[model samples]
Target: MDKRRVVVTGVGAVTPLGNDAETTWNNLITGVSGIGPLTRVNADDFPAKVAAEVKEFDPTDFMEKKDARKMDRFAQFAVAASIMAVKDSGLDINEENSEQVGVWIGSGIGGMETFENQYQNFLNKGYRRVSPFFVPMLIPDMAAGQVSITLGARGVNSCTVTACATGTNSIGDAFKVIQRGDALAMVTGGAEAPITNMSVAGFCANTALSTNPDPKTACRPFDADRDGFILGEGAGIVVLEELEHALARGAHIYAEIVGYGSTGDAYHITAPAPGGEGGARAMKMAINDGGLKPEEIDYINAHGTSTAYNDKFETAAIKEIFADHATRLAISSTKSMTGHLLGAAGGIEAIISVLSIKEGIIPPTINYVTSDPECDLDYVPNEARKQDVTAAMSNSLGFGGHNATIVFKKYN
Candidate 1:
């Protein structure tokens, strides 16, 4: 039997650049950096004082005020983006097909803000002062559970927690569910709200964050001057439907999800495998799964974290995997603008990949002042470009040696 076809019908995002998918895409094309001085807490002592924090976000805009108060910032972003995705997909899972719809959202570290706040409350006041919703709010799976309840999706509901690769794994697993004829629809993506003191301290202690004070100059992926990644927060959700289901309903089709591959380095707790062997395998698996030749790939949204090791290794992996085609492909790291959204990085980058397939525009990697010889590639360098992208892939590499790659093809 042949695998079932899957298509994306709707895309939604709450990013540092915009509150909605359209606005975010627009900002991405225009080369806007969302990173700024950290405002969620006092960053007087931290070396990396800037991040890509979401702006002008009000959970009450999508849900009731009372209900919003009960949710962590991560869950709040999940609910908000899911609502937009459902509305955009025009998928009303009512009495007819409620059982056939599913929700799968992932997060690397969920509700860090909540954990910090509740711990502070416990220390300052008492254990009794902590809210009863603490556990549910901090759990990573809450995003999927809340989204299922919000839209009445009764199909397979779960969350993938693969560090920064969480979002890509979630969407890939959901796509497999549909391809195997297990479900008809899945609301899947990633969300994260890890901009808290503990989160900052943990990353800073590990020396994973960029110490650059100027937010605009920070997160310089693939650049010789890049020091480290800047933390970011956001949510990105996509409504994926069976091809027949979407066509039957006349839903808007953004692009088709053709390939997904995931791998583990099994070599490190916080670094990629030597020379990105795991990452190369993931990309090769994705291309094979998509049944596309290396030459068919037109663009790549790199997992360039602006760290020294990642930039060098990921660049090497791409060149090794694609060989001569490496130079022919247009690749860039949108993290240069949005900073690193952690688990949500793959989610929004996947959305951008689909849009590039549909709109024929490639977003740029800003803040690229100087180039490294080892990290040589087009990188769409500093400006958006107009091109007919036939196929696009997004790569996400995370701590714990997790690597995932998803390929999107222009629906012909």
Candidate 2:
């Protein structure tokens, strides 16, 4: 049987850069840094002093206050972004079509704030004082559940939890669902609200977050002075529909999702495989799945977390796969501006990748004053570049050695 083609119809985002997709994309291309003094949790409590936090987001703007109260922040973001995406796509989810639509969202850490608050309630005032909604709110899958309930999408509801690769894997899996004729349309992405006390403390304990005091330069991906990622929170949602289905409804298509590849390093729990061997394979697989050669890829939204090993190894992986074309490819890490959204990183980065192709502009890796020898590629540093992009690749490598890659091409 012939596989169906999938295209991104709409995108929505709640990020440190902005609340909506257009605002986020505008801020991104302007090289804005959303990293600011860590305010979600008291910065003095931890070594990491900066964070990329979504600001001035009112949940009631998207859902009822009563419904919003039952959800954690991550779920709230998912619902809000999903609503925006559905609205943007102009995909009606009426009774006739509701059963043909699905939802799949993922998260790295779900409801850290909810868990901490409820656990405190349990410790101080006994389990009886805990909110009955604690279990539902604290679980990662509630994002997908809440979105489905809110949007009335009933076909398939699922979530992927592969650490930072959650969003990438979720979108990739959703793409397959459409390709295999499981659903006509899908709402999928990743969400996270992990700037809570415990989340920060845990990352600080593991030294996985940057301790840089300055907010402007905290996350300098591919730079020699880079330390680690800046913790971030948000959600990115996209509406994906089958090609014929999208065309029948006259839905606006952003880009065609052509390929997806996922792999496990099996080398370490925290660190990526040396030289990003697994990452290399994932990239190769995605390109192969897309029926494209390495040189055909015009841009790469790198999973450059600004960490010592990630940038170096990811660079190595690209060279291993693309060789000389690696230098010609316009690569950039939006994390330098939005910080690391962890699981949501891939989702939002996927949006950026699509926008890059649609707008023919590459968002830059900001604050790249110094270059690292190990990361010697054209990083499209400091300023956005305008170029016609035919195809783009987005990558995500998670702590569990999960490597995911997705390829997108101009719809035409």
Residue 405 error for model 2, in Å? Answer: 0.4
Task: Point out the worst 10-residue segment of candidate 2 by lDDT.
Answer: 38-47
Model 1, C-alpha of 302: deviation from truth (Å): 0.6
TM-score of candidate 1 to 2 decimals: 0.99
Please, what is the TM-score per model?
0.99, 0.99
Highest TM-score: give the candidate number. 2
Candidate 2 lDDT (Cα, whole model)?
Answer: 0.96
Estimate, for each residue in 1-412, the C-alpha lDDT of model 2 and write its tens digit. 9989999999999999999999999999999899999998888889999999999999999999999999999999999999999999999999999989999999998889999999999999998999999999999999999999999999989999999999999999999999999999999999999999999999999899999999999999999999999999999999999999999989999999999999999999899999999999999999998999999999999999999999999999999999999989999999999999988998999999999999999999999998788899999999999999999999999998999999999998
Model 2 — TM-score against the truth?
0.99
- In candidate 2, position 355 carries an lDDT of 97
Residue runs of model 1 more than 4 Å from their true location after superposition: none
lDDT of each: 0.92, 0.96
Instruction: Show model 2 residue runs off by greater than 4 Å.
Output: none
lDDT, residue 369, model 2: 94
